[model samples]
Target: MSEQAPHPATGLSALLASTPFARAYTHTALAAVFAAFAVERIAGSVALATILGGLAVLGVGILVARRAEYSLVRLAPTTLLMFLAWTLTTVAWTGDRGRTLAGWVALAGIALIAVVVALVRDTLQIVRALGDVLRWLLSISLGIEILSGVLLDIPIPFLGIQGRIAELGPIQGIFGTRNMLGFATVIALITFLIEYRTLSVRTGVALFSVILGGVTAVLTDSPTVFVVAVAVALVTAALVVVRNAPPERRRVLQWVLGAIVVVAGVTGYALRSTLIGVIGAGTDLSLRTDLWSTLVPLVRFRPVYGWGWFGPWAPAEFPFNYVNAVLRESHASALNAYLDVLVQAGWVGLLLFLAFAGVALLRSWLDASQRRSVVYAWTPLILVALLVDSLFESFTLSGFGWFLLVLCAVRAGQSRSWRERMRSLDGPPGGVETLPAAGGVQGPDISRG
Candidate 1:
C-alpha cells in the first residue's frame, strides 16, 4: 500500500486549534470587560454579571490547559505556600474574620489564575491575554470618563455618591472621587508607555484613553498621585533616553541622571512645605512616621507567625483610626504598604512577601537579558513604580496592583521560555562541527561550531 500524505491544511488547522493563545485571549478580553464595568459604576448588577463572565472564561482556560501535552513549571505551589502562611497568620491574630475571608478568596483566585498560566505550553499566551485586557481597560475607562463628563449636567438620583459629583468637568469620569480615577489612569498610562513600540490601532485607542484618564487625574487635586505620576513620567523618559544612547555612553548617562533625580527629589522634599504648603508637607511626613511607629510595634507583637491572613488592619475599623479623624493628631505612619503588611501579617509574612517580589523581579531581569525582549525593558520600570507606590499606598491589597504583578510574572515566564528555546538550538557545550574551508578544503570548524 502507498503511504498516505496528510492534508495540506491539517497542520495549520491543528496548530490553530491546539494553540493555548486563543484561550488566553478570551480570558484577557473578559478581564478587560470586567475591569471596564467595575470602573464605570454601570451598575452593581452589571459588575456581578462581568465577574461571572470572567469566571466562565477562567474555567475555559483551565480546561484548555488541562488538555495540552506540554506544560510550564508551575509556580502555584509556591504561591499557595505563601497564601497558607498568610491565612494562618490572619486567622491566628486578625481581629476581623469577614475581611480575612475576603482576602483568602481573592488570594485563592489569583493563585488559580497563576496555575492556569503555568500549565500551558506557551506562557506568551498569558502575557498577550493580559496585554489585551489592559488595552481594553484603558479604552473603556476613557470612554466612560468622556461620556460622564459630557452628560455631567444631567444627574441620576439613584447613583448615590457617584451621581452627586458627576458634573465636575471632563476629568472626573463616572467615579465620584478624583483620586480613585487618577490612580486608575496612572496604571493605564504606564501600560501604554511600556507597550508603545508594539501597539496596534486598538492599543492606540487605549493610549488615547490614558491621556483622557490623565486629564481626569489632574482634575482630582490629589497631590500625592499627581506627584507620583509626574515622577514616573520623568523617570521613564530618562530611561528611554538612556536606552537609546550608545552602550558605553549609556552607562555614564545613567549615573549622572540618577544623581540628578535623587538630588531633585531630596531638595523638593526639604522645601516641600514652603513650595506646596504646610498641610501637604506635614501630611506626607506625618503619615510615614506614624506608619513606621505603628508597624514596628505590631510586627514585634507577632514576629514569627504574624496576624492571621489580612487580619490586623481592617480599613473599616483600624487601630490607626486617627487617620480618619478631623483633627489628624495621631501622625501615624502606617501609610507605607510594607508597614501595612507587617502590622497585619507580621515580619514573617513581610519576609515571604519580599521573597515573592524578589523572585518576580529577578526572573524579569534574567528573562529580559536572555531573550532581548522589550517587555523585559519595561518590566523594571513598572516594578520600580510598584515599589515606590507601595511606600505610600496599599498596593498588594488593591486589585489593580495584583493584576499588574500577574501580568509581569506572565511576561517573565514567556521571556524565560524563549531563552531556553534559543539555548537548545545553539547545541551542546564544547561541541565542534567539521566543515569545508573557504577554498572548498575540508577542515574541522574551531569556532565552537
Candidate 2:
C-alpha cells in the first residue's frame, strides 16, 4: 500500500509554518511574545529573558530557514540598524558593563523579534495578534480587579493590585502601573477601532473590544489617559481628513496641519505656567521635571558617549543609583524616552533615535495620507502615540512599547525605504519579500466601507 499523505489542510499549515517569512507560526509566536510583554511583571525579570530568548531562537531559525529569501543589501532600515548599533556600542563605555550588555541584549533582541514579525506578518495580522493578546490581558485585568476588590477584598501585592477597584481605581491591571494600563488600553482602543474600520473582526467582537478597552482605560484613571485620548482623537481626525482629501490637495493640507501644530506647540509652551497651575503641577508633573533636571547634569558628564545602554535604570548601577539618590526616589526609568536615551546613550545616540523616530513618522504619515487603504493609518497613529507618550514615560524604550515603535518603523520603511527603491530599480529580490502575493499589510478584502 502507498504511504498515506497528511491531510491537505494540515500539510498546508505545516508547510506555511516552516516556509519563507512564515506567517502562522510567526503570528502565534508574536502573540505569545506580546502577551509575555504585557504580563511580564507576573514572573519578574526572568520572564523577559525566557520570552525574548524563545523569540530570539525562533527569529534565527526563521532567518536560516528563509535564507534564500533574504538579501543582505536590502535588510532592515538603515535608521533602525544604526540606532541598534549605537546602543550596542554603548556597552564599551557604560558604568556597569555587565548591566549594559544585558540591557543591550534585551534591546537588540526585541528589535530582532520586531524586525522578524514586521517582515513576516502584515499590519492587520500584527494588529490581530496584539488585539488578541490585549483582549486576554484586559479581560484578565478586569477579572483580577474583580477578585481583588469585589470578591476577595484583598490587595494582590505580587501583581500590584491595590484592591482599589471598589473605589473605582487607578487600577494597574496586568501592567505594573496605572499609566501603563492607560497606555496599553489606548493602543488596544486604536487596534480595536482599526479592526472595526477594516472589518477585520466581527461587529460584535469589535464593539465588545472597544467597550472593554474604554472601560479598562477609564478605570486606569491615569492623567496620561486624558492626554493620550486627546492626542489620538486629534490624530485620528486629521488622518480622516487627510485620507478623504483630494490627492492634489493632500500635500497642501499636510503643510497646513504642520503649521497649525507648530503654532499650537508654541502657544502651549508659552502658557505652560498657567497650564501647570491648572493641572496641579505638584503631583506627577513635578516628579518628571525634577527627574529630568537631575538627568540633565548627568547627561552633561558624558554628552557624546553617554552612560551606556541600560533600557530601564538599574537601581544598583552607579549613575542610576546616583540620580535616584539625588532625587530620593526609586524611579525605574527617567520617565521620558528622550531623557532616558540622553542619559544612557548620549548626544549621538539621541540624534540617532530622533532620526529613527522622525524618519519612521514622516514615512508612515505620508503613507497614510497617500494610500487609500486604512491599514496605512495604523503605523502613523501608533507612532504618534509612542512619540507623545515618550514625553511622559519611557515605555517606548522597552517592552511592547519599543516593540510597536520598531514594528511600525519597519512597516513604514518597507513602503518607501532606500532599499525598496533600490530593489525596484535593480529588479532583484528585496530581503525577505520574495514571496508572491504577500504584500505589505494591505489586505485588499478590507475596505473604507
Cα lDDT tens digits, model 2, 1-449, are 99998898666544434533355555555555555535466666687578678777777766555445556654477888899899999988777889898888888888888887776666666777777778888999899899999999999887778978889897987687899889989998998888787777789999999999999988988877777788889988998899889898988999999998899889988997787677554488888999888889887789998989999889998788998899899999999999899888899999999999999999999987877667668889889999999989999998889888988998788767777757655454322222122233343321010
The models' CA-based lDDT, in order, is 0.51, 0.79
Off by over 4 Å in 1: 1-72, 76-84, 87-89, 96-99, 114-176, 202-210, 241-300, 311-335, 365-373, 413-449
Q: How many residue pairs clash in each candidate?
A: 13, 0
Worst 10 residues of 1 by lDDT: 429-438
Cα deviation of 222, candidate 2, in Å: 0.7
Q: Count residue pairs with overlapping backbones in model 1.
A: 13
Q: Cα deviation in Å at residue 314, candidate 1?
A: 3.8
TM-score to true structure, per model = 0.65, 0.90
The prediction achieving the highest TM-score against the true structure is 2
Report RMSD (Å) for each prediction in the order shown: 9.4, 4.4
Per-residue lDDT for 1-449 in model 1, tens only?
A: 99998886665445443445446434653364335425445557456445644654554444443333323332332543674556655764666667677666655555444434433423223334555565555455445554444456353323222332244532434333344455656665665554444342255565665565565565555655666676677766775676567766865776788699789979987986676574354565665666566457656656766555652245454544534353355432355667766766667677876776666665664443333234445555555566666766665443545545554554454434343354455432111123221121223422111
